[model samples]
Target: MTRIVNCVKLGVATEGLDEPPFPGDKGMEIFENVSKQAWKDWLGKQTMLINEYKLASFDPKARSFLADERRKFLFEGNNEMPEGYVPPKD
Candidate 1:
């Protein structure tokens, strides 16, 4: 049976990830409080953030920025889009 968590990001009880998404306390926190769907959504947003900001994943600063953004997006409900970003209408 899949694990269900009180997802902080989605504000609902939902299916949780099988394991922590990253290494360390933050990852464990996410594993405990965030849902699978919310993590997937963050992956997409992270990609957009990297592309929009021209961030290199190898750079420590970029990684730090993404980590901060991840926490804000997941725990704080701050989903601010990058400046000048226009969503494609389908």
Candidate 2:
């Protein structure tokens, strides 16, 4: 059976990740409180952040920036789009 968590991002009880998506304490926190769907959503946003800022994944500073942004997005509900980003029209 899938684990269910009272997702902090979705504000509902839903299917949780099998394991922490991240590492260490933050990952454990997410594994305990965030849903699978919310983590997937963050993955998309994280990609956009990486592309928009031209961030190097191997760089420590870039990794730190993404970690901070992830916490803010998941735990604090602060989903700031990249500057001057426009959504594609359907």
Candidate 3:
């Protein structure tokens, strides 16, 4: 059976991640509260941030920035688009 959670991001009871995204307190917190769709949305935003800012994933500063953005997007309901970000043509 799929896990169900009261997702803070979506503000509804929804399907939860099968496992924590990573093994840590924060990951466990997310597994317990965040929905699959929210996590997928974060992945897309994360890719956009990496691409738009030309951030190297292995760089410490880049990782830090992504982490901050992830928290804001997941828990604080902040999904501010990066400046000058243009969506791809459909």
Candidate 4:
């Protein structure tokens, strides 16, 4: 009996039993992926908002203490952003 059982065990081990899907794999993976995407989207929006405000509130040339680059931001030219910009990553 022991010899027969040992052979059965060897066969099963060599054959490799399949496992059922993990209970939490799908939920955990989706949560992690969405969390990562949300963070990237938030950072992109922050950078864009900072640039927009920096331009919208500009005090131009007469404020000689400011740099030339700063002077150019007083008003939007042909390069103005759309009425309301929303990054598509979200």
Candidate 5:
């Protein structure tokens, strides 16, 4: 299911939506069917840790918002820091 969404997002699939507030397209039906409240709940739980994790660090409160693997994936870049080390203040 996620692969399908990723494909749609990456344009591997040609489907598209007509109106938003509800998303459109061929492969996005599942996402389109999800409740708006659920979408907000998911967003509230987000912690963006990938690709640019070292630009700063995620605070514990933000880390707490994400699932474990997502947390790891966000900060565990090449040559990982020691377990308890926080990103230094800029």
Candidate 6:
């Protein structure tokens, strides 16, 4: 049976992640409160941030920036896009 969480991001009870996405309190918090769909949405936005900013994943500053963005996007609901960002036509 899939785990269900009262997703903080989507304001609905939905399927949860199988394991913590990180390895500490934040990860556990997400595991307990975020839905699979919300997490997937964050992933897509994360990819966009990485690509648009030309962020190097191995860089500590980039990791920190992404962490801040992740919290804002998932919990705070106020993530910002890169300046002048344009979404690709689907």
**1-90: candidate 2 lDDT, tens digit per residue:** 989999999999999999997689888999999999999999999999998899999999999999999999999999999889987689
Q: How does each model score on TM-score? A: 0.95, 0.94, 0.97, 0.25, 0.24, 0.94
> Which one is best on TM-score?
3
* Candidates in order: C-alpha RMSD to true structure: 0.9, 1.1, 0.6, 23.7, 12.9, 0.9
Worst 10 residues of 4 by lDDT: 1-10
How much lDDT does each candidate structure score? 0.96, 0.94, 0.96, 0.33, 0.36, 0.93
lDDT per residue as tens, model 5, 1-90: 222222222324423333233345521443543333333433432322332343233567544424444323222322343356565489
For model 3 the local lDDT of residue 10 reads: 98
Please write out the lDDT profile of model 3 over residues 1-90, one tens digit for every residue: 999999999999999999999999989999999999999999999999999999998899999999999999999999999988899899
Error of 6 at 26 (Å): 1.3
Global CA lDDT computed for model 5: 0.36
Give the least accurate 10-residue stretch of model 3, judged by summed lDDT.
81-90
Worst 10 residues of 2 by lDDT: 80-89
The per-candidate count of clashes, in order, stands at: 0, 0, 0, 0, 4, 0
In angstroms, what RMSD does candidate 6 have relative to the true structure? 0.9
Q: Which pairs clash (backbone N, Cα, C closer than 3 Å) in model 6? A: none
* Alpha-carbon runs more than 4 Å astray in model 3: none
Better of 3 and 5 by TM-score: 3
Residue 82 of model 3 has an lDDT of 91
Q: Model 4: what TM-score? A: 0.25
Identify the runs in model 4 with alpha carbons over 4 angstroms from their true place: 1-34, 55-90
Among residues 3 or more apart in sequence or in different chains, the pairs in candidate 4 whose N, CA or C atoms overlap within 3 Å are none
Residue 73 lDDT, candidate 1, scale 0-100: 96
